[model samples]
Target: MTSRDTVTDPLPSGRGAALPDGGGVPASPPIPPRLLTDLIDSAVRDHGERRAIDFLGRRWTYAEIGALVDRAAAGLQAMGVGPDVRFGLCLPNTPYFVILYFAALRCGATIVNFNPLYVEHELRHQIRDSGTTVMAVIDVASIHAKVAAVAEESGLEKIIVCPLADILPTFTSLLYRLFKRSEIARWPADARHMAFGDLTRANPASFKPVAVTPDDVAVLQYTGGTTGVPKGAMLTHANLTANSHQMTLHVGHGAEANDRIMGVLPMFHVFALTTVLNFSVDTAAEMILLPRFELKQFLKTVKRTRPTKLLAVPTMLTALNKAAASQDVHFDDLDFVVSGGAPLPFDVRQEFERVTGARVVEGYGLSETSPILTCNPITGVVKDNSAGPPFPGTTLEIRSLDDPHRIMPQGERGEVCARGPQVMKGYWNKPEETEKVFVDGAIRTGDVGYLDEDGYLFLVDRIKDVIICGGYNVYPRVIEEALYEHPAILEAVVIGVKDDYRGQAPKAFVVLRPGQSASTAEIAEFLKTRLSKIELPREIEIRQSLPKTLIGKLSKKELVAEEAKKAAG
Candidate 1:
């Protein structure tokens, strides 16, 4: 069978054959369609006294959080937030992200998640593109100032300013107000601005409920992926909730009933939105929240909070491995850390497991599919370097590169396409782009990979990232993985650069671990046996650090542009 015109995957693992009618036996119970708002209500009802959030020693129980959500929802409604209103959340991982997220949804408004690190121009573009009228941001000058400028330029209606020090423990809040005063911004006294404390009032009587449906747009998750063109994936309530359920099914429950998840990944990012935030809320787990992934803070969070599970990007594992080499660090309470949001190099996983004595499970998905389509099972035979298998309601099909409609034979490399309920409705308001991305009902994953006969996905690299070296396809990930096998290399990034001999050739940049070094020649020599001549990078440059996305994935966009500029000049 062939896909029509164009379009996408998910195949269940551990199954000899898929069910006849485009279905498969779920590894666990199927996730029923539901509203994202329902997750909070159920958690509060069943686990009211359970600790819901822990930020800088300040804690809130599920009941407390639910009450806050109620007040915020009422306030949001009074501020004219309801169906069709796009509410933007510009926040780091904090209690505010939790409250505002559900409150906006509870008001029957669609949320547009914004990265607080975005510059004014980036913020302006998304604000206009997403039609975000109201936004909530922290009082930190660096974030709020930019958003404020963007609001002025982009016609945003209201700003709910949250104080940085207000959410901390009393003594810590005092210290922050005294010492970190420079970081806070002074909001202009105007009608456009409101305090977060005021926005979430203490009156439950004023709260009015709006009926939320499973298909309502919950969040407009922006993803550029490898394409470099930012488009908002319209993730609905069902899409977000079902993916969270899929994660629970895949990971199952650890031996202990109480689980604390490390929330270092930014809440704005879909991976964390589903795994850390949504997953934790549904399971009644305490979220040990950090504003960002500072290495010292992460190690302290692991030891201090005793997080039973963590969802981390590759860079976090690298930092932990580097930290463990210097001093004693314990991850004893962690059942296992699931690595996603980027490819997990074998050496990084191996070293993390060996040094900290914590298990690492790798998963794969994109922002378009509610961010999780496949994951390595928590307590099962996990294949090394493969992104495990499809989640319970997903089907994966690998289509030929030349003709995407044709399904590739088993064990052959091609583009992965998936069909599942967890997939987004489409790109927001961009019908042409949306149509281009979908072919035959499956969401086309631009990733180049193949599924093994046993149904495990082994991703090669992004199709756009593949270098056509002397008319032969050469994957940068292959060379980068080889570079990781070296003792000194801490991080590796390879990008296709313009070459006179070949159309495009691979160029490598690496950062060495502390007190460890190897010249380009030594690294080239190391890769001689492992890689073919064509797979070798044209030139290797050693750098103190490499570029990374805010979520900590090693980025190739900057390097690609830098090389292009040099070539143009």
Candidate 2:
């Protein structure tokens, strides 16, 4: 789409500009009424021979990707998977994940993303909640065991397994087998269920795409569920497509089709799902995929790929800076770093700029809004700590957290509310919860932030006690409940502590039952099966008593303050 077609005008302060036309003022491509099938087909026809995805020394061109997607779609069609069916994707970051995601979309199916690290209980909860009947997972023995344990209980009828080296080079496959197998377990025996190779080989490389509308459900994204249970936020094709367009306009001046983007962020998260996956697809840019973020591996990948732009959370940036400082490494080719998903600490942003010699810009959004609302401008002027101005065709307002109807004045901290095309339709199957967040057509992000006089957004704190550790959201209550399940633990309060690389790590203060004893390592290991890696506490403090409020309720705020004081000393 042409720059003029995408935006009405630049921001009033001239901090933001319209998305630049690639070569000239070409006519804007019409936004598809439906997503998934239409976008993939069109990209394949237009950029068929171009490389679309790069991973572990292997690449997949658009034409090759299209063929694989077609076969997968046909295979799914044969399995009676179509509209209204929920398909769970439990694989890591790989080309197969991308292909299956689009293929399922082609058949008018809803994708339910599951973290690969989830155990049996966590897997069962999501599967039963989403009513997922089929799952596409990696051929890892531990993961397969977990899936098997939950399949019957959750009513999962079929399991499709893909190998890690399905697309990797022969030598790399050997290397992985010799070294990485113990870390990422291999499951040759589980290949008996449904081989991805057989599915792709047996099906034809062609399938009819399903017709859908803007309102049709595309993705059922589940949140951290800090309150009670994890719930899916129902996002339509229009919601995602509109957000992509809005973000494209917000940061399009310097980004080009030829620019290389690092896709280190997990695609399962909403921020990366839209920015790294869909945005890269829209711009026809090549993406360098990292399966998981390991400091050494990530640095090596960055040095090899030399990506010009990066979309990462604050934790990733912190890690990059620490690695560079401790190892004396350098990153001279990076152009810009975009931080989101959690509030970016001022210190991390400053250190990243000093180490990488690139601007680290911050943005803000929620899963309910296709995950992007504001971003620092790529041209004119930039703001260091603020999530620079709202994207085109978007409006932002701060309202009291207790009273959503009252709009707070500028520079005053309150709940951030957003209104734009990117806003989701509602939460999946929860009308009461949906009504609570959607007020006057604006999505109420439980995050508390304020807008300055110039319209730049500055986050203050989260209304919910959602702890962000290494870029993953850890609900304090979830961890506390898990600890409470232990017989030795009487009461527990979880809080975040500053860390050099992980941004924040969970620290639990526990009041054990009288005369009961447990080591920190013991408690951590006990909760490992119940919680994800990121949610586990780095340290546990056994306390004789926990501070309580006037009404005898646990006070986590006081604990956080005490920890901050200790750090300062």
Q: Judged by lDDT, which candidate is best? A: 1
Model 2 lDDT tens row, 1-569: 11122323221112133322111111233333346566667668888877888897688877888899889989888777799899889977788788888878878899988888987888998999899988988877788778877887789988888888667878998888778777554444543367778777645644655776666778888885436357898877777877777667776642244667788888888888888888777666678888888888877877777787899888788777777777754467677888887778888888888887887888877777888888887665667667777866667878877787678877888888776556666778887887777655567777788888787888877777677776677787788989999989999999889876677888999988988988888898899988888888888999999999999999887898999999999
Q: Backbone clash tally for model 2?
A: 1
What TM-score should be assigned to candidate 1?
0.79
TM-score of 2: 0.90
Best of the candidates, TM-score? 2
Summed backbone clashes in each candidate are: 13, 1
lDDT of all predictions? 0.81, 0.76
Worst lDDT run of 10 residues, candidate 1, spans 1-10
Error of 1 at 404 (Å): 1.3
**Model 1, 119-190: lDDT tens per residue?**
566688899999999999999998898888878779799999999888999999998899998988999999
Question: How do the predictions measure up, each by TM-score?
Answer: 0.79, 0.90
